[model samples]
Target: MNTIGSWQNHAISLGLPPNTPVKKQIDEFIRRWDNFR
Candidate 1:
């Protein structure tokens, strides 16, 4: 998948809205990256 597609997946998996702002998405991902790590 493309980068945007992957970003959407990440947001969805985190229970975030697909339309979430990019900065919020990044913060959420960073906060929960241990799930992947």
Candidate 2:
């Protein structure tokens, strides 16, 4: 349900580097956020 723009914003907010691929960023972001819960 995430749009590209919002996905990128979430990735950035998660402190993930922009140089990586979006798929990777999303996966990592999910992992990190899950751990935080």
How many clashing residue pairs appear in each of the predictions shown? 0, 0
Off by over 4 Å in 1: 1-9, 34-37
The window of 10 residues in a row where model 2 has the poorest summed lDDT is 1-10
What TM-score does model 2 achieve against the real structure? Answer: 0.49
Which residue pairs collide, candidate 2? none
- Model 1 Cα shift for residue 18 (angstroms): 1.2
Query: Per-residue lDDT tens digits of candidate 1, residues 1-37?
Result: 2455766676776689877877898888787786778
Model 2 misplaced stretches (Cα beyond 4 Å): 1-18
Residue 23, model 1: lDDT of 88
True-structure lDDT of candidate 1: 0.74
Model 1 clashing residue pairs (backbone): none
The global C-alpha lDDT for each of the candidates, from Candidate 1 onward, is 0.74, 0.70
State the displacement of the C-alpha of residue 26, model 1, in Å, after optimal TM-score superposition: 0.4
